[model samples]
Target: MADVHELQSLLGSGEELTIVCHNNPDPDCLASALALGRLAAAAGIDERRILYSGEITHQQNRAFVNLLDVELKPFDPELVVDRSERSLLAFVDHSVPGANNAVPEGTAVDIVIDHHPAEDVQARYVDHREGAGATATILAEYVRDAGLDVDATLATALLFAIRRETLGFLRGVTAAEYEAGGFLHGHANDDLLAKLSTPSVSGATVDAIADAIDNRSVTGSVLLTHVGRTSERDALPQAADYLVTLEGVQTAIVFGIIEDTIQLSGRSTDARINVGTVLNEAFGDVGSAGGHREMAGGEIPLGIFADYTSDDDQLVAIVEQVVRARLLAELKLSEEDGGE
Candidate 1:
């Protein structure tokens, strides 16, 4: 458990606090930011704001925000730079200052609270527990230990965050996450959670999933596919989740091009294979990639797309071949092994 006293002391008095979430903020990131904002309020910080840079295009994430009335403002680089002297900056649900997050590189961070693998980032206070399932679980501990008031809205958000991050406790979950879920269960609104769980999927998501199915290639227990062009990057993860459910499939890697960037999402049920590490090894050299053991994501700019002036199908086919070969080689699989 992190020292609540130290966190409060870092905030000091009459200092504005800005809580920055990672790009394309998920339920865990949003809920963790809100929960920490509540902590700041309890610590007597009057001026504080929760900010995120990327779009929240996930249906469930949108529903969670609407159902809970969680407020998050857009990050303003100018405002952050201007307020750098008088304000304190804190990050939640992300460890490194700039990796895959809105915070600029080399920015001095006051506090960092996360559940992912820790990176070598300089911060005055960092509470990173790689064993924990969700960052919300860490914040829930602060709320519990400090005896802070957790309203129904915050409790429901925290509980939902934990559930989504852990895939209803089916993924990487520890005793701390279980305890947090149990504690938040008492205060969370059951009706609201049920509503948030059943978000309507968009047509794009359906098409993306179908494309993944059509393009899927299996080598032993590994499955890889490309969904072509996608309007929503979140659909890649949904497709990857669906692919991993196929019979005899131990790992699934799905990729799609979104706005001239190739986004990849991977899921693994095999305990011995860490999908995050696999993605980092495969794509980290050319792009940014990393996540938890069971789930991970990465993105690479589609500069190669400009090399081909041919039709879209041809371009996608070439890119898919390149990506598939790289991933298979990293996974120790080969095309000659009847993958296609």
Candidate 2:
């Protein structure tokens, strides 16, 4: 159990606190930040800011923010400097500062609340549980333990966060997550959740899915596809989710070029192979990668891809081949054996 009382004690009177979400925050991250903000306010903290650095490019995520009315500020270094003496920085959903967050390495962090695998993050207070499906689950525990009143908005956000993170209890979920869901179900707005879950998709998303289906390759139960250059990076994950539902597929690896970097998203139904560790071992040398047991994502700069070829088609081909081969190898499925 995490200690909410200790957290309350950390925020002294009149001190400012800033809660930061990881880059490209999803529903889980946003919800966790909002819940924490409320907790801080309840603890009598006068000044608090919820900050995130990356764009919320996913339509569902954008809808969630707008519909839920969760307030977030764009991260500004000036804010940290202005309140340096009185500021206490806390990270939610992401533990490693500068790994996938805007915070730089070596900067002091006051608190870390996350459900991701633990890393060596130096913070005054840390609560990390790898078993929990969503960070929002941890936040829900805090709200419940402290006997804090969870309004409809906060309840809906937390409930939605758990659902999204766990894929409706289908992936990487534990008993605690179910309990958290049950707790939030009574308080959350069911109508708002229905609206948030089913947002309108753009033409780009459909085109991306088509590209993924056309370009997909199968090896045993693994499906690999590159959606070429996608305008919306979120479409990669959506494509992966769709691909994994295919009859013979137990794992899906989807990648697309956005801006200058190749964005990767993977989903796995097989419990034996940890998708997060596979991604980390395969791409950690070249770029950043890590997540939960069932789903993970990564990014590699185009400069690295450019090292092999300058031709656009050749670059895409080489990237696809290299990434697929590396992933398959990591999953212990040989090309000859996995191929249909």
Candidate 3:
């Protein structure tokens, strides 16, 4: 449990509070923010004044926010503004200051609650647990232990976050996570959970999947696919998961340029391969990358993609070659010998 006294003190001090999530906020990020905001409001804080960053991009995430009636004021990333001295900032789901879902540099953060690896933080209060499936799981504990009442909508929001971010508890989950999940499950709206879990399929998603399948190439046990450009960032991970189901395909790499960034999503069923390491080796020099052992994602800037566009096919071929090289290294296959 977090320090209730500290939270109480912040509330008593009457500080302006802002809650920020990472760019492209997912279900966990949005739901956790909503839960925290609800708690604060119940304790006499004004819900209308709280500021939130990022636009809801994923369909289910948008639905969760709408269903919960979570009120959030818009925040601008490009605007130069002062971080209120009396303002308290609480970051959820991430720790690093410049991480994908982090407050911009020079902004003071007062609290951080996360399930990712700990990083340097200026926040006075920090509770980080990588073992938890999602930050929403930890936040749910705070709500339940506070003996505060969460409405059915808020309950469903948290439940959806836990399920979506954990991939139905198949990734980065622990025993305590299940306990928290069970608690939320008891009170969460089953109908809303079902609807959010399976959002209506979009035609663009189908087109993207077809493009991925048509462009897929096999080299040894490595399956590589480049889908050129995409507006659906979330689909990259879905494509990665689908590609790994192919026979003899132990590792899968899906790459696509989205907006100004080139995204890479990698997945592996083999215990020997660390997709995180492969991601770091492949894009660490060019951009930022990180994740779990079996599933990892990375993003390189548009500059790198532009450089490769001189010969589009050659550039994709090079990416595949690099990924295969990393996979072969993981498999202990010599360059002279073919991949496993």
Candidate 4:
């Protein structure tokens, strides 16, 4: 368990605070960042800036931001962060410099509070509880322990984040999450959560899911699909979630092209397979990838690989071939086990 007083003491030493959310901020990270902002304010840090990298293309994420009025700035590469005593940099939900974030490599980080699996995290105060389902659970622990008054908006964000991260207490849920949910239940607005649960779905997301269904292939107990190209990277995870329910499929991986990067989202029901470890083994050397046992994602850049063809179809084919081969090989699936 992390010491909330120690976190408060660390914040008290800083004059300014900057909370950074990982690339493509989700409810978990957004709520965690917002809650951290509140903590920093409570710690006598007046000036605060919450920033996020990448696109907020997810519909539910958009709803959460608009409804909760969670203020955040888009990460600007040209913006220079003052590293003097006036500034303190903190990361929420993600615990690294460049990995899964637009923050430059080797950048100084003061605080890191996250629930994901991480390695070589460099921060002055790091509270990485991998056992917790959501980073919000950890933040809730602080909020509950420190006796910081949580308003309805903040409470709703935290509660919604916990639910989303744990898939409604179905996946990756822990005791901390349940405890946090119970505490937040009184404060969180049920009406807001209902609205957040059913946000407008983009046509692009539906199209991507359709494409994934058309392109799916099964190898042993695993299903792999490529959606060709997509503007909504978050749709990959949704498609993965949908595909994982396919009959006889124990695991599902959905991938697609987003500009020059090949992005992937995977889910697994098989106890034998740790989706995060499988993804790291398959793609970590080529790009960046990892997550919990039930959920995983990867982003691989197409540098030399994109030069294989001028046509988009050819590029998709190449990516499909490479991704399929790599993942199946890592899973030790034989060609004889392949199916459509």
Candidate 5:
């Protein structure tokens, strides 16, 4: 059982609290932040703020927020964060600093609530468990254990986040996630949940998919693709996830140049491989990146490479080669000798 008293004590102290999800607001992130906010409110913390850095790319995520009427404000790095003011910041779903879903410059993080393994923590209070399927699941447990009344909208958000992050309980999830999922299943709004499951895809998403599929190159069970100039960084990971579902594919790597950064995402359906290790081993020195066993992502600064075309294909090929080599090395398959 969590020490609700500790969490409640943190909230009841009249300190300003800001709840933030990673830059790209996925269902799990959105759900976790809102659930935390709900908990804080129950503890009489009325000034709690939920801030987001990136836009909601998926229709389902937007719809989920709309249905829940969650009031999330856009994160402006310029919003003066006074360190001396004794403010508290809590992050959900992601742990890395400067991540797309992370707060911009000049924000102080005080607490972290996450399901992913802690890559690095600058926060004062953190609860990180890689075993939990979704951050929302952990938050759900907090609300339930606190005996707080969770509304239908919040329950729907939790259910959607748990379902998506766990891939309907087929991925790296735990018993606690299942218990929270069961609770949400009983209370969530059925109509809102259904709508979020298969929301309408925008033209930009369609174009992004076409480009990703068209650029794909398959080697063994791995499919590598590039999408250029993505307005939505989260779409790259989602696209990589989509490619892994192909008939012959067991792993997928997608790269894109968003602004000046070379972003990469990797996914694997196979149980024998850990994509997180592949990313950390390959790009850890260049930039911050870490994630779960099967899925991971990272980014590299483009300025390091010389005379790079900055074209999507060229940039992707570079990132892909690095990731592929690292994955092969992790799997004990190399260019010189293919081990049996």
Candidate 6:
């Protein structure tokens, strides 16, 4: 549970508040930042800003920000330095300072309100509830208890964050999520929700999905596919999500060469396998990756093969072979069991 009064006290004490969102934020992180901003506003913090480390690559995320007119700034190192007596920095959705975000490891954190599983959190006021389906669900509790009038924009964002994080109340749905959804449902704008749910799917995304479908390999119940190159990093997760629904397939791994790195996304419905652990075991030494048991994503620098090749086609081919072999070995599937 969140220390509501302490959060308010921390906000009130600070002249300026910086709410930091995790890198490549999804709806849950963005909504949590917005809700925290509202709390800061109510607490008399005049200068409050939401900052994030990476690009908002997903279609729904871009739509969420534009349609709601959300004012977010890209994180800068200097923003961490302020001359004010009481400068507060809060982290939402992600806990570790330098792990998933650009914030330095030793930077002081005034408050942390999150739903992700974490440990050794060193914030003055911490509310890290892994039980909550979405961090927005925890924020909704504070907003309701504070007796603030929930605006339509915030309500819609919060409600959608909860729904999207839990996959429309189908996965990881808890009682708190249902309560949060119920609280925001009446105040949420149905039209805006409809628009946010169905944004303009990019041509790049369609092409990536087509590539994933065209080039797929299977081993036992595990499926792996790589989209050679794409400008859209978010397409990897969408492709993985689609592949998981294939009959007889319990796990799906979708990877692509985006920019200079290999972006990998995985989804698993197998009770015996934890996709997050498997992904980390497969690629954590060479890159950064981790997530829940059911879904995971990672990025590996192309520098691993920088001296080996320069051609785009050749680079992708190397990544495909390496990624497939690594995941297969991690999954404990024999080479003979693997087939396209």
Which candidate, 4 or 6, has the higher TM-score?
4
Q: For model 3, how does the per-residue alpha-carbon lDDT over 69-106 read when each residue is reduced to its tens digit?
A: 76666665432146545556778877666666535676
Candidate 6 per-residue lDDT, tens place, 46-157, comes to 8988999879989999999999988999998778755355878889998888867899888878888887666689888899987777899999999998888999999999
Q: Which runs in model 2 stand beyond 4 Å of their true positions?
A: 307-311
The ten-residue window of minimal lDDT in model 2 covers: 77-86
Top-down lDDT ranking:
4, 6, 2, 1, 5, 3
**Model 1 bad stretches (over 4 Å):** none
Residues 202-261 of candidate 2: C-alpha lDDT, one tens digit per residue: 998899989999999888889889988778889999999989999998889999888788
- Model 6 scores a TM of 0.95
Clashing pairs in 3: 22-101
Total backbone clashes of candidate 1, pairs 3 or more residues apart or in separate chains: 0
TM-score of each: 0.97, 0.96, 0.85, 0.97, 0.87, 0.95
Per-residue lDDT of 61 in model 3:
66
Q: Which candidate is the best by lDDT?
A: 4
Give the alpha-carbon lDDT of every model.
0.86, 0.87, 0.72, 0.91, 0.76, 0.87
- Identify the runs in model 6 with alpha carbons over 4 angstroms from their true place: 82-85
* Model 2 deviation from the true structure expressed as Cα RMSD, one decimal place: 1.6
- The clash number for model 4 is 0
Count of steric clashes across candidates, in order: 0, 0, 1, 0, 4, 0
Q: Least lDDT summed over 10 consecutive residues: which range in candidate 5? A: 331-340
Give the clashing residue pairs of candidate 4, or none. Answer: none
- Put down candidate 4 lDDT per residue, 165-209, tens digits, no spaces: 999999999888899999999999989999999999989889989
lDDT minimum window of 10 residues, candidate 1: 77-86
- Candidate 4, residue 210: lDDT: 95
